[model samples]
Target: MTTAFDPVRIGALELANRIAMAPMTRSRAHGPGATATELMATYYEQRAGAGLIITEGAQPSVVGQGYPDTPGLHTAEQVEAWRATTDRVHAAGGAIFAQLLHTGRIGDAALLPGELIPVAPSAIPAAGQVYTHEGPKPYPTPRALTEAEIAETVDDFARAARNAVEAGFDGVELHGANGYLIQQFLSSNANRRTDGWGGTVEGRIRFAAEVTAAVAGAVGGDKVGLRISPGNTLHDIAEDDVEQTYKALVADIAGLDLAYLHIMESAGMRDLTASLRARFTGPLILNPNTLPEPTGPDALSLIEDGTADLVSYGALFLANPDLPARLAAGGPFNAPDRGTMFGGDQHGYTDYPTLT
Candidate 1:
């Protein structure tokens, strides 16, 4: 019987196992010019037991950044800095993919260069606060991107994808999930534009599909993946009629034949996953967002049952460096310290001891 420990092929890259390390922001990019530091390399290399390591969200442009200490890929310096981390992961026999993220309206001007206000699909303020260098502040109403700016944003994603390849990453994953820029366009409450970019399901999905196509064109189609969280209301996004919107989205991008579609499991979305699995004709990575319960046997069962080709773990992979071996043994898992999950030194980042 096929198991999560079995090998799987994601696009042109061959994964040693079916377990993927989901991207989690560590806010430890303490290098000059928002570059990835050697500490980040050591951190990823320690967790290289994952079949595929999806690095933390990387801002594609200066204004796209949402948080402090997060890395970027727009400049030559950023790309060069990421190379060492990718090289370390590869040396450890792991395939790494840089997750290109554009935070959109989920940002604060205080966190951006020159205090640049965030741009979103619409000029509405999210119903929550965003963290900045000063502290947490209420989300400011973002400026809507003009048609020309939207085009430039698409080009930004494509350029970031190319930069990931130049940084020695095996591939790139577009961060279309959460309530970020892509999801900002997908949500009805967030995207109220009247142009071709909004007002309908087809229009709303246009930005995501166009971004995917452009990235795939810049890199290889098989070297690109997308992550989506339908019905996710994070960052104050209101995704009314999630079923209709996501079905249209999946249908629109199915023809792209990209590497994989990563779907985060949400409450009341099981049937939607089933429908999406049938609709998308490529590999699927399921992120079972069930916390407290360890993603050990249950996640493998998803792969065994054909609901997902692979499974991704976030906190488990963060605390357990040799997660594959630990899962195989099914004993003695380390608990992650919530305090150090975000910004921190090597204490919780690279000091996790592997089974000896």
Candidate 2:
């Protein structure tokens, strides 16, 4: 039986182990232009022991931003800023993938330039609050994106993927999960359009398929990946037909021959994941733990049972830098500070002590 510490091949990239650092939103990009800073590079460099590192969600465009202080890939300066971070990860013998996120309707105008209203698949307002410089505010009803604008959004993702490659990243992962722009289109409640982009399952999955194909076309298919949550209700997203919807989605993108399909598992969604695994023919990275539960022996079991090719850990990897060695030795592991999990200085970001 293969262990999680063993080497695994994901598309054209060869990973040293089966462990992956899942992307978590750390609002520490306080650079001049919302670009990645030296501190961010240090944070990632410290945690470069993982087989793969999926950086925090980066907005493909200015309006794609949903949170405060998150990074973007829409500008040349941003790409230049990210290059240093990627170089550090590469020097440390780690492969990194940039995650492209468009927050869609799950945003506030206060976070946008000139108080620009956020855009989504439809004019629906997610029933929650979004973080802003002032504080948390109720999510506003986002403007419906026109068909032309939707096409432009697809191009934005493609351009961002190319920019990631230019920034020295190994690949790009499209954030199609967590009620963001792509998931908003996947959810019938959020996307009520009657045009070619909505109504049927094929229509709803069109955006994600197009975005994946565009990114694969921009970069190589082996350098592009996608993440999805089948029954996730985060950020007020409701998928009435989770089974059929995600099945259609997996089938639609199965032929892309992309790098991997990352699935953030919801509670009691193992059968759905298995079904998706059958539909997809590439590498599968499974994030089994949601909140509160720490990833440990259970994640390894997913790999041992062949349910996942790679297992992703978020909070555990955030807290422990040398997670692969710690797990192999079965010894001490550092606890992550909840308060410093978001915006903070080097204290919780890069100050985690490694096993000496």
Candidate 3:
């Protein structure tokens, strides 16, 4: 029987354990040009015990940034800064992947540079507020992408994947979930275009497929992964045909021979999860059941039962630096500080005590 403690293979890389640290936004990328700081390296180094660590969402381009202080993977300085963190993690015997995210309609212009507004498949505004340096503000109506610009956006993801490799990351994961740019195109309500980028199921899934193929072309397919959420309503997204949308999306990309497919599961979507699990022939990483609590020790059984190839933890891994050791011991884990979870100093960032 497989346990979370067992080793798993993702592409050419061999993970030490099946327990993975999910990508989370800590809002602590406080460097110039959104470059990673040495302090950030310390934070990841502390958690190097995990089999794999997926870093926070990094904007692939300047306009892709949706929040203040998030990191990027588009420039030489940014790549050079990230190389420090990746070098440290590799030295500590850990594998890391940079998640390339483009927040289309979920951002405010104040968060971006040079007065550039958010871009989406359509001009609709998400019905919520995004946090900025000033505080929380309403989401601005995004400019719709032109047909030429859509091709350019795909190129941006490919370029970022190349940049990620240059920074010494083991791989790159496309942020297709969580109401970001990729999901915006997948959303029925958010994406109201009639072009090849949106409209029917095939058109809606086109952008995602193109980006995946482009990234795979840039970085080998074995070094690429894609994350998705079927029925997630975050950022005021609504999917009338959630099942059809994701099944088609999975089928379209399954032949890419990618590294993994990560699903951020929502409430009562286990059947859909099972279907996707069956359709996708690669390694499947599941952050299961978004309801009563964060993914807990109980989810370890998902691996034993073959429901997931690897299990990802967000808050649990954030608070417990040596989470795998704690789990192996049936742990008395430390609780995460909510207030300091976002943008703060070392109090909640790297100050979490590990069970020694």
- The C-alpha lDDT values of all candidates are 0.91, 0.91, 0.91
Per-residue lDDT tens digits of candidate 2, residues 199-263? 88888999999999999989988998899998898999888788998898888878889899999
On a 0 to 100 scale, what is the lDDT of residue 58 in model 1? Answer: 97
lDDT score for candidate 3 against the true structure: 0.91
Which residue pairs in candidate 1 collide?
Answer: none
Mark the regions of model 3 whose C-alpha exceeds 4 Å error after superposition: 291-294
Clash counts per candidate, in order, are 0, 0, 0
**lDDT digits (tens) for residues 1-356 of candidate 1:** 78999999988988999999999999999998899999999999988889899999999999999888999999999999999999999999999999999999998787776758999999999998987668789999999999999999999999999999999999999998899999999999999999999998899999999999999999988989999998888998888778998888889888878889999888878899989989998899999885345878888888888889999999989999899999989957899888888786898999988899
Model 2 CA lDDT for position 160: 96
- Model 3 Cα lDDT, one tens digit per residue, 1-356: 99898999999999999988999999999999899999899999998888899999999999999988899999999999998899999999999999999999988798776868999999999998998878889999999999999999999999999999999999999999989999999999999999888889988989999999999999999999999988999999888689999999999988889999999999899999999999998999998856444445678888999989998989988899999998888888898888888887788999899887
Q: Candidate 3 deviates by what RMSD?
A: 1.0
In candidate 3, where is summed lDDT lowest over 10 consecutive residues?
289-298
Instruction: Please identify model 2 stretches exceeding 4 Å from their true place.
Output: 290-292
In model 3, pairs of residues that clash are none
